[model samples]
Target: MKDTAKHQGLRNQLVSLLEQKGITDKNVLEAIKKIPRHLFLNSSFEDYAYQDKAFPIGAGQTISQPYTVAFQSQLLEVKKEHKILEIGTGSGYQTAVLCAMGAKVYTVERQIELFKKTSVLFRKLGIRPKYFASGDGYKGLELHAPYDSILVTAGAPIIPKPLMAQLKIGGRLVIPLGEDVQIMTLLIRKNETQFEKHEFGEFRFVPLLEDKN
Candidate 1:
């Protein structure tokens, strides 16, 4: 009973926060509220879960802030049956959001420890994604090719070609680009020959490195 009440309070606060930040998608807001962000953190930091800041989860990685996760998820423009590819699983908060939105998520985490940790947490949270891979190969999840949307949480100097190839025609890719600082970018496939690109704004994220563990 106490646990349910805590979750409800957190949900309400998160919904209010999302609204203040202009996250208009009701589905997205509901997903954010439904997923328990505290489950992704260590017990000591669980109390801070409702706060809207990135918190460290070891391995030099941080669970992305609620706004960033919501912002990225919104940019993906996921459909009810969209097959989504996530480049960095991190703490799996973003993946949870995508799954909650009714998308089939294929997520890859480069760190084995974080990957395994998040996998167990996902089971506990009951936010099952379509695929979860732990290891170095994060170019893209090609086995399940032609995803409707691809979201890269890590900021990369250049978008990985494999990820671009995995997108079906008319699919969308949202990633953060540049070094030192980053800008969130949205790319839409306009047939095989070209892509339409849009820059969202300045953002800060951990550099997306090729960690082949």
Candidate 2:
């Protein structure tokens, strides 16, 4: 009962934060609510898990801010049956939210240590995504090609070609693109050979590396 109450309170707080920031997608909001954010963090930072700020999770990488996670997820426009690909698996929080929303997620993480920890957390949460790989996220996941939606959690100087090739027609990819300064851009695969692009807003994230682990 205490655990249920804690989750409920976290949900309320998260919904309030999203609503305040104009995250109007009800499905996205519910997914973010249902996932236990506290479980993704170290116990020392669990109390602040619901806040709209990033927290360090060792290895110098931080779990993304909640609003950023919700905002990127809202852009994906995920449905119950969409096959989603996430390019980074930091702490697996966003992956948890994606699975909670009923999407079959295929995620990749470049950092082996982080990937291992995050994968264990996913198992502990009992949320089994379709695929989890510790490799080059810049290449995206090809085994599950032509994804309904793609999300890149790390910042890149430019859109990665392999990632572009993995998008299905009518599918959309939300990514943070730029070098030192970054803009969160959404790329929609309009057809077999054309892509429509739009910028969501300015944002900052760790650089998307090309090395495969």
Q: Which one wins on lDDT? A: 2
Give the residue spans of candidate 2 off by over 4 A.
1-4
| lDDT for each residue of candidate 1 in 19-97, tens digit (9 for 90 to 100) | 9989998889989888778878878887788888898898899888899999999998888989998998999989998
What TM-score number comes out for model 1?
Answer: 0.94
Against the true structure, what is each candidate's TM-score?
Answer: 0.94, 0.95
| Candidate 2 positional error at 19, Å | 0.5
lDDT of each: 0.86, 0.88
Instruction: Per model, state how many residue pairs clash.
Output: 0, 0
Q: How many residue-pair clashes does candidate 2 contain?
A: 0
lDDT of 2 at 32: 83
- Least accurate 10 contiguous residues by lDDT in model 2: 1-10
Clashing pairs in 2: none
**Each prediction's RMSD to truth:** 1.7, 1.7
